[model samples]
Target: MTNYNELTVPEATLIQKQLRDNIKVTPYNGPLNYIAGADISFNKFSTTVYAGIVVLEFPSLKPVGYSLVKKEVLFPYVPGFLAFREVPALMDAWTQLPVKPDILVVDGHGIAHPRRMGIATHFGVLTQQPTIGSAKKKLFGNYEEPGPEKGNYSPLTDRQGELLGYALRSKNKVKPIFVSPGHLVDVPGSLDILLRCIKGYRLPEPTRLAHNAVNQFRLNEISEGWTSLL
Candidate 1:
């Protein structure tokens, strides 16, 4: 595993460039028994990070289990290198998970980055999991606004017109969510899984549940370990 800490921005950029060759893009067509979402939370003035991964049953989207971790991060906040600051805590939480999910929905970008190395891709490379980025904000791609209805989407491409991901309008009247393939998955697979997880909310059930879980873990001072909801 690469060292999570003790790296300059230039060194991080170099690493990103190297990891691009290792990212595999294949459409996932197997039956999904479970799916999960990963999220991280922290204050602007603190190095402490709260990471959580929530697992839900496929189709039903019922909460089955979750893993949470609170740790003091060592790396400084950087624009594109956020994985260094938050992935370590998430890895810790992953270790505590009872069962692994079929695919992970990350609260950040995947290949939709300047060097095609976003947090989701970084984590997927380390853990070798199928991950999809479901970000609230766009980082490095241009796309037309999706139609003002559920399930409408538009292609997100780079300056050279290379396909990266999609801008999906998850809910009516709300801003679209950016979806990108991380690893072991293709653009169609990423969007298909996310579209199935939507439940009348802007964010999908997996990520929305994960975002809520981490915030509760931080605010309510919940324990940092596996908490099965089953």
Candidate 2:
């Protein structure tokens, strides 16, 4: 992976804008062989990235192959620049997979960013894969509350009156998850996949598994007395 830190502000900003402008918002109507999620856990010194791929029997969400990868973090964590710190380890983990996933679900913002290029956007552009961004919290944008029921969602718009994505209620009465197109997928298509993946949970199954996988590594590191470098 190349160091994005080497790029000047103008260069990076231009690159980000180009990506956002050229994004494909087409509906994702492809085969769903596998659904994967990527997440990261970091101590002060090392960061472990875990990507879990579940090969579901088309339309039936079931796990088949699962793998993980952990590596030391090379970049420091900076707000709005998390992709630089996290994508290296993530790409390492992703490339290690023997069975590539059909759709990737990321745990961060997509177009809902100051630069309109969040971690999900960066990963999708770099890999040219079908990806979606689902966040636990809002990064930027304004939206009305979704209906007090599952499957209800509303558009999340930016300051310039552009639709970024949707704030969706995955589970009844639970907190809504922010959904956005990372790449080949559109906002509606991303939300559809998320809803299909939800089995009465706040998070989709693939993402929940990935989150647990990464947190497990974090727990093990903490128990081993590894000094935090974050």
Candidate 3:
């Protein structure tokens, strides 16, 4: 794993630039039976990362199997450098899964970042798996508001006017979520999968479940007197 703390500013910038320059924005046509989501929660004493994989009956979006892992954190949070703090533990959790997932839905940014290498991108590159970023808020990008109806979406472009992804409305009147390509998937393809995964919810089922799982784990840890770091 690349250590963010050890890299010089120039080196980090170069690495990020390389990542963006080499990013592949293409449609994915491989098997997508198993889709997974990963998330993390931090405490003053530790961080808990969770990854949940669900096998859907291709195009039907049904659950088959799921798994999660939690570990004590050893790194601190840093903005625009979050992959370093979170990806390690998330990788550990991912490796524990009995079956490899076809698509990974991470609860963070992908190309919609200052470096275009968010948690989803980093994990996808490391695992060499197709992944999508479904974030609850915009990390970087500009777009007009989507329609109030479900399934409506608007483009989310970066400062340089590059098409990053889409801000999609999964439910009527609910806040839209940002969808972006992580790896092996284009912006439109990412949005398509996100829409398929939404079963009348604000977020996709896999991501929503993973978020809930991590938050619940963190809440339990806090109830047990663990101090929160983030």
Candidate no. 3 TM-score:
0.84
Question: 18, model 2: CA deviation in Å?
Answer: 5.3
Model 2 CA RMSD to the hidden true structure, in angstroms: 5.5
Please tell me which predicted candidate would have the highest TM-score against the true structure. Answer: 1
Clash number for candidate 2? 4
lDDT (Cα, tens digit) per residue for candidate 2, span 1-230: 55664665556567677767766667888888778777776565544444333333335666554455666554556667677767776787677666677998888977777877888888888888888888999988999999989999999998877988999999999889999888888877888888888888898887786776667756663222111121
lDDT of 2: 0.74
**Residue 159 error, candidate 1, Å:** 1.5
**What clash pairs does model 3 have?**
43-229, 44-227, 44-228, 44-229, 47-73
Regions more than 4 Å wrong, model 2: 4-15, 18-22, 44-58, 220-230
Clashes of 1: 0
**Candidate 3 weakest lDDT stretch, 10 residues:** 221-230
Query: Order of all candidates by TM-score, from best down to worst?
Result: 1, 3, 2
Task: Kindly provide the TM-score of model 1 when superposed on the true structure, using C-alpha atoms.
Answer: 0.96
For candidate 3, lDDT tens digit of each residue in 164-206?
9999998999999999999889989999888889988898988
Per-prediction TM-score to the true structure, in the order listed = 0.96, 0.84, 0.84
| Model 3 alpha-carbon miss at residue 16, Å | 2.9
Give lDDT tens digits, candidate 1, residues 1-230: 56667888889889888888889879887779899999998877887889999999998999998999889887897878878787888898888888899999999999998988899998898899999999999999899999998999999999999899999999999999999999899988899888999999999999999999999998976777898876
Instruction: Assess each prediction's global lDDT (C-alpha) against the native.
Output: 0.90, 0.74, 0.75
